[model samples]
Target: MDSYTSAAVDGHLLTPVTRKPPLRSSADRHGPISKLGDDLLVAILIRLPNARSAFLCKSVCKRWSSLISTSAAVSFITVNRAGSTTAANNLL
Candidate 1:
């Protein structure tokens, strides 16, 4: 039976199946960053230092534009800018 197991269906059996290769990380798959959840992506975008950069990111695609246009995202940027202004005033 072991010998026949390696033989083809007609009469010969093939070699035993081997283990599967390791899975690739999501970032390694060349998928768009938009595949990430909106909230998560928003968190990442909010860290950009410049509002212009964030606005430019919106034009990358429809999903990104929609995310950036959301009320929460807009408010976040506004708050961030206000905070930066406050920090600059404190430094003066």
Candidate 2:
């Protein structure tokens, strides 16, 4: 397709294609999860508006879904977002 049509076809402006590795890679020893490790991913998730990471990692794999739902991870994320739940309760 022509460059002009490609850009205009979608609402977003299109740019020249660039090569990039996939989010996940089986070949890598660290594997696909290397894109965002457990610690970094957890940090990013907590910064989101809500528990959006739970929904996102669900489709990644059953193992990932289980990992995010654990009490430790959930509590950590909750705490990082805005302190303990008790603080929120006090505000309410």
Candidate 3:
């Protein structure tokens, strides 16, 4: 019994198992993912539930900071709605 116990203690049978890395964070770039280009980033932001998250992405970095500030996105939205210009101007 002592020899059996010693053998088991020195063998792989007593070794602890290591866990695999978590997968969800690796696969999903859902929000504020790193290394994204500006155009693709805007596409992701548009899919968010609302404009607040879109605007918050600006603080992520300098490139993102500038991309959201441009008139292109605003133009895209305004074109979709004719009255957007007047409403946006009022907000400004």
Candidate 4:
């Protein structure tokens, strides 16, 4: 060790830095479904009772919406379903 460092340690001039781990919220305690893989999420969504149910489910959660869009979910269930117009861009 360098003389300065050794002297500093001997004199307790440098205190060790302590770091605390990030805290998890209550949602982390019981929401295990969020941990589902994308394939599983899509599969489960694709098996809904009907296209309506699938479309409704798409807005259930942000993650759910991200995993499956309303039209995508409906199309997955109804292979021959007709297409709809594109959604307009969201403006501020």
For each candidate in turn, the TM-score is 0.50, 0.42, 0.42, 0.48
Per-residue alpha-carbon lDDT of candidate 1 for residues 1-92, written as tens digits (9 for 90 to 100): 55644447666557776899899875566476737776566666656687777888887778789888888787776566423544333323
**Residues 29-75, model 4: lDDT tens digits:** 53888777665666665555556766677677786776566556445
What's the TM for model 4?
0.48
Model 3 lDDT tens row, 1-70: 4333443653445544589976665226454465565555555555554566667877876667777778
Better of 2 and 4 by TM-score: 4
> Would you list the C-alpha lDDT of every candidate in the order shown?
0.67, 0.60, 0.56, 0.56
TM-score attained by model 1: 0.50
Whole-model alpha-carbon lDDT for candidate 2? 0.60
Q: Give the Cα RMSD of candidate 4.
A: 12.1
Cα deviation at 12, candidate 3, in Å, is 57
Model 3 lDDT on a 0 to 1 scale: 0.56
Candidate 1 residue spans exceeding 4 A from truth:
1-32, 81-92
Which has the greatest lDDT? Answer: 1
Which pairs clash in model 1? 6-13, 6-14, 7-12, 7-13, 8-12, 8-13
Once fitted onto the true fold, the runs of candidate 2 whose alpha carbons sit more than 4 angstroms away are 1-35, 52-56, 82-92
16 Cα displacement, candidate 1 (Å): 42
Q: Which has the better TM-score: candidate 1, or candidate 2?
A: 1
Task: Output the lDDT of residue 63, model 4.
Answer: 69
Ten-residue stretch with the least lDDT total in model 3 = 76-85
